[model samples]
Target: MPAPQMMGIYPSDSISEVAHSLPIDPLGPGAADLLAGDVEYRLHLILQEAKKFMIHGKRATLLPEDVEYAMEALNVEPVLVPPRPLPIPSFQPVSVSSTSSSSHQAQQVYHTPDDEIDFAAYLKQPLPAGIASSAGVKWKAHWLAVEGVQPAIPENPAPGTSRAGPSRPQPASTSLRPQARAQLPQELQLYFTRLTTALVPPTPSAPETEPERHRLAALVSLRTDVAVAGILIYVIKWLSESIQKCLMAPTGTIGQLVDAVDAVLENEGLFVEPYMHQLLPPLLSIILTVPLGPHPPSSSSSSQPSPYDVRQRAAEVLGKIAEQYGKSYPGLIPRLVSTLTKALQSPPFPSPLGAAHPPAGRYEGAVLGLAALGSQAVKSGVWGKAGEGLSKIDELAGRLYIDGGKRKNPLIRATIKALSPLITAKPADVQAPQINMNEVTNAFGPYIANGLVKKGWTANELLRLRKEEMEEGEGGGEGMDMDTPRI
Candidate 1:
């Protein structure tokens, strides 16, 4: 049986015709047949390689560039052709009558027409405008997924949905729908992804590891990047959600989130005054929420910070906000003081009817938050005169002390911390005024009096600071008086 014919055929007649046209002697039948078969085989290989290129490019139609690439890959000399606007032309069929009258049948031939250009008309036409050069290429990294869930971001292809089926409308609920993150620019989306992932890394890293470095770098970007205004709302939303999720099981992530807030506040380029209302709720929640995390075992030697430490960091961020925007929003500090004071004054006593009472952690957090507001805040919110300010605190402390002496220690420590801003030591040369313990106790109640005594504060100094704070509070504005108790 004859060998099977290949997909392509370069006839020996065509090869002979080409040889005759060239300045060479006509080839023999065998030479012409061998050349035709070899040409056909090479053409098949080139087409096969080009098809592979097309598949790799995820395209159905083979392109001229694909053919060029295939030729280079196959070690064949590539044909350099300029790119054209139109696709390759198809062949047109023509029928010709036979020259001999005996042969009545006509012969058919297929011919490809050449492209024609009018140079004179092209030269007369106006030149098109040159395209502007693009910015230089730079490398950027972003998270594709965290814990197996892909973040809805512009960098990732949108999740596929069936276009053939009718879309179902989702029911509206009280919960807010997440922001349309797809509309954000690709750069901002990537930046947000990197910052959030670094802030709360999935796998905890040692202080010296790359994740820690990345966290610090992300914070630095937050503190210094001028172009981050576009992402401010999203960052704040992520922060609020992360804080809520981690509140019950406090981790280093909470502290990192607080640090991110502080970093955002530190950025001089951003005008954070507008978002302060949204920002304060999360910070206040950190301050007032109870059971932030499981209390660490007293015997554990792990280096991780406790939930109290996270609260302290959050309080510091609150302080920064007040200090930075207090003048612009004079009511801000007052509002914070009011909220914190309510938390601090909530009765810790167990109800006779079995009603729940606020935990001691809330009181401690309120104390820290008040202390962070500065000396004036401490005096107004924590050091009220005779049954007005901190009266509830003294009662709570006394009750805790009577029930369990050691249990009261944390509250006393927190009280002292709150009063630290008001404590100013007398000069070494000046004799410290001495006061009877009984008088101090009767004047300011036993709880605060003891805390003052521990800090070496004389009764006269306490009275003097209280008087000054009252005077300042009166002169400041009506808002300041709202936090202060009536005389």
Candidate 2:
């Protein structure tokens, strides 16, 4: 056995290197007389050290440990240094080394990686005799906890300098080290143990909402997530088409729609519902016309691509599906309305009516959403108050697309068409169906009437449609553009 190295040999040697005798100078005392034999042996010890200190052509003699080594070599007997001729190398070797001593030495040499973790425990006590467990600990992979903004590891932790960066495990150190454990208060030890135990075993991870996001930049990279998003959109839209084609999709499909929507909304932080409300009218405009034949009029097909048979279809369909299942989708329409209302209603900056809030692209969206509900109603033959829905949207977004310069917007004309009967003087015998017209008429009625007025239609025609609206002054009903659900 080579035997365990004693602490006395290393750090004790270092401390003794300095003279107990007061130094005559700040640089300190020089070495006293030592025998030639001692100098030779000391040179031998220097050779034993690993070739770690070489710089240029010279080895440094500056370490405190070097001084102690020199002193020890000096103490050897005079005869040992007496010069003699060197012998040739021998091939003979000892048979075997003792297993017990070898194993112990291995244990002493091979520390668990966790022993190298960040803090130097020896500094908290007495300074360590030698380099404390190889500079630092491996960052135990187990130490990773819930993610949040982590503070920087300061070169100098004291206030002032710009933060270096948040500390993260060096790539080499990213591994689990079972031996590493944090000391905890007795009161909290079990809690910590439980936490560490829970963390160390790889907890089941929720599926990657976006692994593709890592490779692709948010704005640029053609989203791999786009495939996923597209699939979801396809599924939802197909479900929608199936319903529109089959007259009301199965309730289970509705569940799948919800799950898909929630998964998307949660992941993207986008509300597909309102966007659908915004997107669908345009899509259904096509879908509605899909029934209208092979030589479908250029008027129906021109200006935009159809929203069906593709994933881009999803964006439009998302809004409609949300409208399809009211109340089941909270934070859907109201939130959308709030955002879109702010945008459309916002004046240009440095103008009247509050700081020009950003536009939400909702004016057309609201009209589209209400119209989608109308399509569903019309398809199901459920007129309920969809007629009234058209009216309500009229009060809020004032025939902007229809009369606000762009007489060319197809959606504007579509809105007028759907509610044409309600807006024009309907014969009393044209019975109102007991379906939801609130989403339709309230959302579009006024706009239809106003379009008539702007087109120079008679007042009799305005009076012809049921004016559920509260007239401006007398306010018999809700005033112009009240967004409250007429349902």
Candidate 3:
């Protein structure tokens, strides 16, 4: 039997037409048949590769992009075709009579019509604007939901809506306004809210009684809570703002703020070293500010401790800070001493040279602050500079005594207290040598000498301390000179 002839989807007639269009003689029967079969096989291979791409993409139908990708994968040069809708071709029928006339058949051919243009009209027409190129692919991120609540933003889908349409609106009472969620955990947020609320005092008009009980509880939490480091910044911010508000117009709240500071300082779990800069300003302001709260009415006999008492408490807090951090931050003590010295040295009244003099309350606070820094600071800041600090205090105290008398005058007591550290012997059993009163009177001036005598300090102790202070100053000056390099 003869071998079977293979069939091809491409027609020999189409191959012959292509040869004629290339300005070559129409292909012979054998050549046309061979070419048609090869072309049909290549088409099947290309289609097969394109089908794989469509399946990989999970697409039901093949696209032009898939065909391009398929051609590239098969090492064939892909056709560069602009994306457009495929035009429908019209089919026309033609009758052909064979040479024998016995065979006649109708053949159908499909061809797309060419688009005709009128050159004259086309030349007169305005040019179409060029299409802008699309932007390159980019990626961005935005929060879709936080803590199970979807945020209301353009990127997030609207609530109660879908691709179909919006659903019915819920009742006004049932719908809640979306609030911005805190970055903190839920438990921490609740704790912070409760802590701050309890710490802040109630306003005078508010009927919430027992603000003290709440404040004390809050302070205890600050002192004892172990996991409060996370909220440390928030607490510091609250303290700073509260101190500022209280400084502007002090109330019982100012005293509570001091207690809160002390409580935070006492917490061993907190690493407050980083926040010391922020903590110090408010504390210093409290210690140095005059008349922390309004003076009580003279007619009423109010038993509340005056603003001076609050200032004293502030000084104690400052002293604790200095003792704890003085070694770590070497400049802390000097800076504090400088500030208090300036306040202490200011004239009791406005000077004739128009210098700004701090109030008597500030003078008292300065003396207390210097004394709180320990004996060394007291010696250097108050009793150093050839006893100028003491002379200034004596002048201020004299004026106070004349106005309010010695019993009521706080400056007199503060000055005496500041002197105690210098005059008191370090060892209990150590005996100070006896010195003449005239030498003591001349060395320290009359007022300080008299005050020392009144405070039960002997002339010998006063002169001895003054002599030691001078000798230390001379030794420090020599040490500095010896350490200096000569050019």
Clashes of each: 0, 51, 0
Alpha-carbon lDDT, every model: 0.73, 0.36, 0.71
- Higher-lDDT candidate of 1 and 2: 1
lDDT, candidate 2, 125-207, per-residue tens: 64455654667733332222237533444422343444575331111121222432233234333433332222212221222
lDDT of 1: 0.73
Better-scoring candidate (lDDT), 1 or 3: 1
Model 2 reaches what TM-score against the true structure? 0.24
Per-model TM-score versus the true fold: 0.54, 0.24, 0.53
**Whose TM-score is higher: candidate 2's or candidate 3's?**
3
lDDT of each residue in 1-487, candidate 1, tens digit only? 4444434468878888889889987675377777888998899899999999999999999998999988999999966656877777799989988898889899988999778989878656654444224355334468899998777788876767434453422111212234545667767777777777777666556788999999899899999998778888777777767676666543465677788889999998888778887788888888877666534323332556776777888999999999988998888889989988887777774533343543566787888899899988787778765325655677777665555332435666777677766667677887666666676566566776666664445566666665677677667777667657855
Model 1 residue 225 CA deviation in Å: 1.4
Q: After superposition, how far is residue 201 of candidate 1 from its true place, in Å?
A: 1.6
Q: What is the lDDT of residue 281 in candidate 3?
A: 88
- At residue 306, give the lDDT of candidate 3: 67
lDDT of 3 by residue, 1-487 (tens): 4333548778988888878879777665478778888989999999999999999999989998999988999999966666897866775544554556665655455555667999878666654444224355334578988999889889888975754542322111211113312556767767777787777655432334577678778899999998778778777877876686566343456677788889999999998888888888887787777555544323321544566777788889899999999999999999999999897776565433333443577777887888889997887777767566666666666664445432435765676676776665546676545446567557755555555554334556656666777888999999889888752
